[model samples]
Target chain A: MTRLPGTAKTPGGLYAAPSLVWLSVFFLAPLAIIVAYSFLTPGALGGVEWSPTLDAYRAIANPTFGKVTVNTIIVAMGATAITMLIAIPCGYYMARSEHQNILLMLVMIPFWTNFLIRIYAWIAILGNEGFLNDLLLSLGLVDQSVRFLYNRGAVMLVLVYTYLPYAILPLYSTIDKFDFSLLEAARDLGASKMSAINRVLLPNIRGGVLTAFLFTFIPIFGAYAVPLLVGGTESYMLGNLIADELTKSRDWPLASAISMVITLVTTLGVLLLLRANGTSVLGGDDHEAAEPAGEADALGAAR
Target chain B: MEARKLIDISMNLPHCALRIEDGSDSVAGPVSATGNGLPRGRALQGGIMECGGAKKKTVKGSDVVIEHVRKSFGEFKALDDVSIDIRKGEFFSLLGPSGCGKTTLLRIIAGFEAPEGGSVLLDGQSVLPLPPDARRVNTVFQNYALFPHLSVFENVAFSLRLKRAPEAIVKARVSDYLALVELQAHASKKPSQLSGGQKQRVAIARALINEPSVLLLDEPLSALDAKLRQHMLIELDSIHDKIGITFIYVTHDQQEALSVSDRIAVMNSGAVLQIGTPQEIYEAPATDFVARFIGETNLYEADVTAVSGERVDLLTAEFGAIVVTATNPPPAGSRISWTIRPEKIRIGHTEPRAARDGINVVSGVVAEPIYSGFQSKFYVDTASGAQLKVIKQHADWSDEGPELAWKDDVWLSFSAEDAYIVEVRR
Candidate 1:
């Protein structure tokens, strides 16, 4: 076999071999176990039986599973849309402002605290006897404390709040790499301010926007913690159902099948997103989708 | 001599009419006489012509009149009471080092920046109130900021498309412009696919397709390598020649400004030091800044002692009692400074027997000699510890020549006509 210059047989492969081994051991092996569990029949006790059957996959067609799937899609899509709407402008400002480091630091401040603690803190602020209701009641703006927690609105608010930083970081990276001079050039060529942003600024940073959308959407789709704490019965999603099947009902086969279905759906969604953006998950050659020549040189040379 | 004098008089007479501060009837008379038409003359006199009419005139370009423009950003005065007049169809350069407001002035004319206290008149109409999109001007930005997502054809067609021109007309015009820049074959390719020079050509084509009265170029060639920059400079001049539109080019490169500009305004510290033709700016620079900024020169502080019709004798600390040619000499007992370009000075192995009336010579020892292919530069240290630089062109290819090595005594001679008197600003 011909040895490449930077692989083990060449230098590069030798360097990359450790990470490949790690992924196979920690991720692929567990995933393979899950797939096998989904195909097996349940045991008389809590373990799986040796016989293979399609009963777990058939159970996925139940009406409750259908409701959970639709609810998950709604919450995930809503949170993704709302988070992105706020993140795009926030990212643009963070990237273009003179005080970019300070703004970025502020965006990252919430990440320093634990994720579960931050969601709980939101509950303290939004609950009936919490800070907001107490302030409103004292100010005579409300006759009584309103029920703000344990609702769909509370779940969505917390979901958008939780994933906002994820959206902004990727969006900022992409928009920050954009050459601001393109906007000026567009205006010089007779484009109005609005048209310039629409034509030049938005199109150039579409990759970042797409990346931000997918980064928020995927995690929110399988979200469980925030919904359990703040969401009411109507807000229960697929993640809640999966937990119920695995723990309360002890139906490992059915839970594994649902988990597999969720994974398949999310994987398809990611693939679709990447395809629409003309990018490959593995980052193959896409000439039209590549960064502009000057921008690439500017960034590469800077590094 | 009389015929030459008559030619000089005739040349200056028309310019005299143009130099009228009020810009009244005398200006119109000569402008009309030059076949610019009576309507343009009346418009020029009134300073109230429509921008469209101005563009349609046979003159083919708009005149830019900046009247005492002053701009400040917080504490730093970027443009301090600066004024200039760019004639129609002229390739004018705003030449200065960084932070000298050359770029700021170009931006103000493009309506990207608004001055605090001056009016910018384009083709005799004030454009200060107009926004960038409304103005009939386009800029070729410094980095050739072509849109990355668009094809080369779409980038060139951008302005026409914005105006909602018909599809057929837009296609034909865009293709024509692409052919002009020699990028028709690469029209479908994105900007990321082309080389640096190709990107710059696309930028130029995009700016020109608008057919603005004045095209602003903000150091458009600074990003390229030396070879490509020179090649592009030639192409830019030819494009300007063919289109005959006024070009306001901004650059800090003296060679670029000198090689391409019909008139150049040399700026320093947010102020214009001098404005003139290339020869006038080089041969008769108005200030010490202009003299030092434009080229290499040997400057000397001297006291004027005698003035005798076109020749002034000065007492200098270094070279004693030097005589210089000056049409307007400073009065006796006044301190002055004069500059002699290195290329103008002649180096000799031995001193000549007699000095001519308009010639100044000084004896010095060669401090250093640097020899490139075309010329040799010698730093000669005089008796008073002043180092005067001199350049000698290697006209003959033969290596055989009178060699002046380190510490060799030599004499430098230069004519009074070559030494120019510059103002010593406090």
Candidate 2:
């Protein structure tokens, strides 16, 4: 298994040699280094040292680190759930109508403006003296000034707004390709409107949902921007802790250890997801993952 | 500016005035341009009226009616003032080339599109305002939008689940339709796991499970290969026979339409140019468009010199003159087209025995011989500077192999009855 795939079998050594060399030099070597670093203790200077220790992983079970992990999961799951809820209906509507280009553009136009700028715009909108508050006060809907920023709710809102386009695009691609005839087929079979959506539409776009979740969830799990800018003491996430370890405290060993632990956890989570769905995470590049019917249907449904 | 161009083009669409099939499964005749007067005495030439056989025969009422339905996409008119009546339980076809609004018309019937100007009726009730589910008609879309996420069994059972039917009944019906499409073994397989033909059958099973009043197919076999299409056609015919539901099948493939539809509605630029049985449409046409579109034909522009009971004498600039006999299409005038089927064109070394029967024959030189296995097509240059198409059956050619060489002068003769004046109102 360690030998280059076709190197031993091939009568012609010419084709096999270059590929084997490239794989060893580029892929296998870097991966080995990463694995070794994950298990090793950091040097007093900066880089990996020779001492083999499980202390890096042991510290991951600490209450503070555990809380960060929990926070990451919640934010990731929250962002994913919110994006799915908003994207599915919007994507479906856009796909069904003849005027899809305009709708698609509406979803994308916000993207042309810088991501940081969009986040800044949100700050203005959510500020106590912001446009929303002003409008509400002018309309006599609110009695006094109200703060909507510097909280988990604010982070969730920004996550939804920032990652919404990503979620919708995958969903739209899957949905746009949907053979509406299947829905009609369902209807002809005595399926009602709600039934058609539930049976046909929902199942078809399951991939888009999972894909949208992964695309948004993974990034938001490590997201620091909206949370940092909007949040204060309580809203500090795993990203802040990693940055604090590496920068504020000048604790390279602890930082590298934290980095290694986070990487492992993420890799494991992804692998578990891929596995539970009967998809092979390993062999993805060499051979395609055999996605189960549900995920395939979901992905295709959204497209 | 582009939007304005689109709106202008859309607003000026012509109407689709096609025949109406009714609840009783019979041609209720077309909604006459004159008004609500049914064919009083002599409308259709034959007793080609009885639509469906046996069982429920309700008062003849149009199942579907479209009046001045028009739609546009960015300056492209998809459906122009299209009006058509699809009879209940009849296999009706909408035939046209690509981008000719045939699918648009089908979508309009299915309530997928709201016609800008016009109303659609299903079972004598107006359905323009109704949603697709409320319209009670199922559509078999061209691209079999089978749920890729679902196993064939689950895809078929989805609608049943939606309707909240008994689990056992859903299982039974799904199994039955799966057996019908010969995909019982593959039912556990998802649409992605199935081949294109298998997916198509699953689509059919899914649509048929609802048993809609009208089953609309938008080029259902367009994706399949020629061989698979042939098999699908047989399966479609059997399914239609067994279910006896109105099949509003749409396709640009003339052969498919001619083979399946009881009556075909030939549409052009949104307007229905002609509607008739496959045989009648191929034989006697109501317009030049119809003559050219339905089958292999030869058309020659001629000046009308005289007219009598169901016959017109025309002077051909190049061939001197010829008398044409035809069924009454409209009031004849000068500058009419003379159309004849390729098979109707006769070529012989010896004089035709029935040449005395006022045969309209013209001298022509064979310019090209195109072999088509069972038949050879001869493209000939007539004295009139027009190319006349002639078909020689392979059996008739013998060892000669339609031996007419290039530029070989030969007399092309046909009985006056074979030549018809094709819809010349000029």
Candidate 3:
């Protein structure tokens, strides 16, 4: 059947019905509920009350909440930085390697196991009497079993492991689509091998790097199970704070407010990522963003 | 023209410094360190000098000497015992069909591929051990691999940035090179936004900004349409003239090689069949494959019947007899092959005159006449069943359509000097 020209704003919107319905029902509705509850008063027992109040937002400004926010940002940023450092080389290798299918399969194999099960597996490997401690004892490397579990480092480690694949996949796709001859061109133009990768390959694949960063950082920012399973007393995060607010303190409005904060931060990050990647995805950009502050530096030199 | 003047003035100082440095024979400079013995900084500084028009016209370019370069990919021989000495500042070409080792040779020279056993020298200095980055050479890749993320200005300014030149110098040089390529208006545009021809110009400008001694072009015009390819070819030639650097171009298109190259090396099946100028390749091809590949021609295998002073008579199975002129005539009773171009043979409607001293005439019936607007090509079947192709040009208005129709009795005559012996079968 032919469609009327002006009736539908987007003719392809009909094909997008499944995703639209799924997001509205499962995502947007819950998000709207959380936003509404965040601005209301908490009931005496658990649920939010009908009376409107700003107590939940006022609680977020406290010093204890400020510490948790700082801790969460540190864990997310540190883990994301380490994951990207490893994933860049891995993605480059997979993109250029002849055995791409095998490498891709290996990258995806971790997702086959349950998330909590994998965190428990890390515990088994890193515990005081675990396989690593046993091996260290047998090798006479340590006089006593090392306490490798229940620390902030452990939480960051598990977070990195959980989100490594999310970072690798996008980086791999972008590196694979890159024209490798540009590297050769860079080399032919007197660039060192390292310089070629930094100046040409990295800038060209900026879209993938941004996507990988968002993919890992957003998930690691809202991480719950890994930190709960592997972390010690000092490793409390926004996700655990929200969980405690809802379950232990019986504060529904505070939990919704915390959740709203996480969602707002992540949404801002995603918007920023989309803006950076919109032109790059189409293989066109102003390219002035990546340039060094040469003019400013020159002016400084002049002075 | 302003770009040329700027290049000349900027190129002079670096060149004088290079000459003094070369005299000192210092091959251990930090900037020039390579596995190769010679200092690359000296060569790169030498490259800068070659970009100057007036000074370089006297100083000349580098001599590329390839000595017995051999390469193999698994069981397939990509380049086999190939060697050529390219002159300074020459526009040389490696002409061949697909998979004929032309590109392989160009890659070896560019330092992208290492030969199994050989050495390449630039101006009497070994460059085989130098990496692509160390070698004083650049390539205009076949696909025009302009950096997609970079604007036209940044792409051309890449080498300058690597050298950490002053920002003002970088901008000025980039603008000059862009003006040299007639792409000043597109300086801020990214490579993806440019058309195929425009991208090609960007690639050229980017490569030329480095001022390498030898510029290697691997079929740089193959991506463009016919009319655009021709236009770009002219532009490339003019660029070569303005720069006066050694150019080693690789292409499978015979017309492009013939029209642009100062000398051409015709290759086939990983072997160099012949090396000559366009006229020599077209008129006196070394072998049957060369004859067929260069242009349209009628080739026949015949047994030599007699040999005289600069003249040889031969008898073929299809055609009864034929006479041709050869410098070193083959002995009588030997099998040989010869070729004559279609345009060289004259076709007439009626018998005109007696056969001259060097003219060989034969009578045939027109089999197929293809009238392409400017010229007419006729395939004539002789009485003995041999077909000879002849072309007639329509120079005036009166010679418009087919002057002679199908099955018309026509006389085809060509001078003995027009035919040349291509092969002598043992």
The C-alpha lDDT values of all candidates are 0.82, 0.71, 0.82
TM per prediction? 0.84, 0.75, 0.86
Q: Provide per-model DockQ scores.
A: 0.28, 0.20, 0.29
| Candidate 2 vs 3: which has more lDDT | 3
Model 2 lDDT, residue A260, Cα: 65
The fraction of correct interface contacts reproduced by each prediction comes to 0.46, 0.28, 0.41
Q: After superposition, how far is residue A46 of candidate 1 from its true place, in Å?
A: 5.0
Residue-wise C-alpha lDDT for candidate 2, range B28-121, written one tens digit per residue: 4432222121111112213322212222111222266667788887688887777776655557899988778898888888877777777777
Best by DockQ, which number? 3
What candidate 3 gets wrong by more than 4 Å, as runs, is A1-19, A276-303, B1-59, B352-354, B395-402
Residue-wise lDDT of candidate 3 within B1-426, one digit each (tens)?
443344334333423232323323222222312222110112234343223222212123577898888999999999899989887766789999999999999888888889998889998999988989999899999998888777888888889989999877777667667766788888888887899999999999889878788999999999999999998987887677556668999999999987777678999998899987666788889999999999899999999999998899978776677789998888998889999899998888866487777787888999999999989999999999989999988646754334788999998888889999999996
lDDT of 1 by residue, A78-119 (tens): 999999999999999999999999999999999999999998
TM for candidate 2 is 0.75
Ranking of candidates on TM-score, top first: 3, 1, 2
True contacts kept of 3: 0.41
Residue-pair clashes per candidate: 6, 19, 0
* Residue-by-residue lDDT tens digits, candidate 2, A211-287: 77678877787887878888765667877787876667654556666666666777788778766544421221221
Q: What is the C-alpha lDDT profile of model 3 across A124-194, one tens digit per residue?
A: 99999889999999999999999888889999989888899999999999999999988988888888899
